[model samples]
Target chain A: MAATDKIFQHGTLGLLVPGLFDGTITAGELLTHGDTGIGTLDGLNGEVIIINGHAYQAREDGQVREIAADETLPFASVHFEKPDISAPIEATNQADFETQVVRDYRLRNVFAAIRIDGTFKTIKTRVAPRQQPPYKTLVQATATQPEFSGEHVQGTIVGYYAPQLFQGATVGGFHLHFLSQDHQLGGHLLGFEIEQAELKIQHFADFQVHLPIDNEAYLQEEFDNETIDHAINKAER
Target chain B: MAATDKIFQHGTLGLLVPGLFDGTITAGELLTHGDTGIGTLDGLNGEVIIINGHAYQAREDGQVREIAADETLPFASVHFEKPDISAPIEATNQADFETQVVRDYRLRNVFAAIRIDGTFKTIKTRVAPRQQPPYKTLVQATATQPEFSGEHVQGTIVGYYAPQLFQGATVGGFHLHFLSQDHQLGGHLLGFEIEQAELKIQHFADFQVHLPIDNEAYLQEEFDNETIDHAINKAER
Candidate 1:
């Protein structure tokens, strides 16, 4: 069936929004589900980017290093599938890229694994502060987050595109994370101007989300979905 | 992992809300995913309830019969697992049952396969009018749908419990369908007064939703999540 491509995701952005950052899903275990993905580490430590079976953590303090196999991830989306469609994309910034992808590729209602690799005229990224215990909601934690940018940069953007209905389950729209070719700069993609790039997208007809069923915080806590929606929009948007 | 239990679902409520009723996944294929389940037949002919490997359709015209293996399903949630927790439930009606289930079973944030079997002092059910080509939205189709009731009914309630965050992916809360033991009545549950009922619930950390990617109606059409949400609440509530 053409509907066979699947995306496996661990934990919802809903669980992460309310400061439930303690996680046990290891990077080693996550790779078993998908060779490429994007997420944040336990305690909402740093941004996680997985590509070609290798995982890396882009710290908020501006350090990109390989993630330990045992490193835990609170939330992530992964998939192992060859692209069904590959083409050149036209867009000036991240928002424009998402808008065009939604209009041109017609992906506003479904999940798509997106990868963009090439040179760029400019690139901008941001990362949340490494949080600790007694953690605050995502909106509070990212209140003073840092941003980084460069001109004439070359990098790859990796992430998943979820429909707006999945806002609390995951960040809606294109939640892309970037990494430079030199492995020196990267985090969540905030904006970019591509000089030249190739877009590879795989339609995920099957979306499998694994929740934190065993966690006491997840099972016992009273989650506020409406509030989380606002918090996610404020933090990610 | 207690998180290993999965609910395999075909299609989403979001797709159904947009009037994409034609389906291709056969009843036989659906049973292969789970021994017990709930859904609707293709073209929205009726409510489908599967238990103990047998699929039955509660038609809108009051005919309850075994569903053919070739029958197609537009949407369904099924799982192959024994209950993690089973207990006696106390509730005066369906709403009370749901409120107690959410509060006592701690199922507000998780996906669960729920079954309640026993006698009821009174029962109420509904079935949407069948549609052909040029279908209307689910809300419109079910606006004046028929409702049936019975006193001292012996039957089983079967369906899935989806968290509010999954509102579009599936109906939020308990979307149960009923089937009488004598095969005299059944359909989407509306209201009920239980004499006594046994509650069997399986925690499902894994929720896998399959979309009709090949359906032209699903692919090209633009969907409004806000409108769908309101429609679902009106129709289901």
Candidate 2:
């Protein structure tokens, strides 16, 4: 199979990049696999947004900057969005948007790669600050997460509809990350009010796994650490 | 990515072979992708077992036969298992076996492709019979599933550990299908008493989706039909 047809995941959510020191996978290398996805920089430095083949780092203080190809990521999940279906959605809140997608798009059982583009009358987001070791769980790392709320912003929501069974495997339901169309603001999506947006949907029927078994930090850590789930849901949700 | 590193899936569990008439994906074509996985024969004729590059059909009458390359499948998920970890396990029942695996093998939080070979003191299994058109949900079709129990049998348990989040996506967790060493008995695993067993494990770090969009039967079905989840759990679990 071609590299572009499958989802590329580095590191497991079971082992969140808490060992920020082990950010061995470079951003440039990740881009070769997919044109869009979401992830974090070394040290949980900030939330990441990759759209249209370029990477952006959204920091906790509500700052967004283009990341260089040399930048490395401890973990990330990305896939090229080749839409099989595209439609427009009108919703007042985040819940309304999801219901409309499920109802109108009929994307219930399959894995979906979605790109929603347009204006948001109100958008809420958060970015995790840099951390130090002994690294804490992802939830703990983001204990002091900074929230950014803005109005009249133009951005795109890049995310996937993970099947419910893969809840802890990936972000169970619709997991989305946002970036302003102008590339000025972005972070893990908390909520949004859509003024208007067009949705581009791609259905995925295959899966691939990219393990970090070779990394020293990955191998040495106890990935089955029980707290990882709580951390993952907190961070991703 | 090589074919060995990805899971090849045809059609969606939500769609099933409701239109059993649409089972156009040949076993030969599916085998070209991976060597180990499970599915049902066309028309949900029987449970399917593919291992070590060969296909076997376990029918409702307790008969097992090697399937022809040209045999078609409505849906299946398969991948070559390359063990990153292997070990021995001892347990009396299925539940005990799973707990021992999780505790000793530490296969939590990620997807696992596993093979368990050994002598079974007792084995309990079931096979879904062929369904007629104007088909019912998988659960209903499987309501009269035939049960088979055997003792002093030697076999291998072929299965995958799906993360909880992917609940409806693929059997949710630890889905195992058994094939007797004598090649005469096999079906979806229900319960078992293991005399002793050895395990070979592979961890997946990526995923790919292969949809059956070209099949006429697939195109005519409604995948979002809500009854699919109940049917899937009943038939799969």
Best by lDDT: 1
**Candidate 1 wrongly placed segments (more than 4 Å):** A1-4, B1-4
Local accuracy of candidate 1 as per-residue lDDT tens digits, A34-102: 888899999898888898888998899988999988989889988885888899978867778888888
Error of 1 at A99 (Å): 2.8
In candidate 2, how many Å is residue B213 off?
6.1
Q: What does the lDDT read for residue A139 in candidate 1?
A: 84
Query: What is candidate 2's CA lDDT for residue A161?
Result: 80
* DockQ score of the complex predicted as candidate 2: 0.27
Q: Pick out the ten consecutive residues of candidate 1 chain A with the lowest summed lDDT.
A: A1-10
Expressed as tens digits, the lDDT of each residue in B103-172 for candidate 1 is: 8878988999999999999999998778997998888888888888899999999998998888877898
DockQ of each: 0.70, 0.27
- Residues B68-141, candidate 2, lDDT per residue (tens digit)? 98888877778886877777776789998888776565555456787889988999999988877777667678
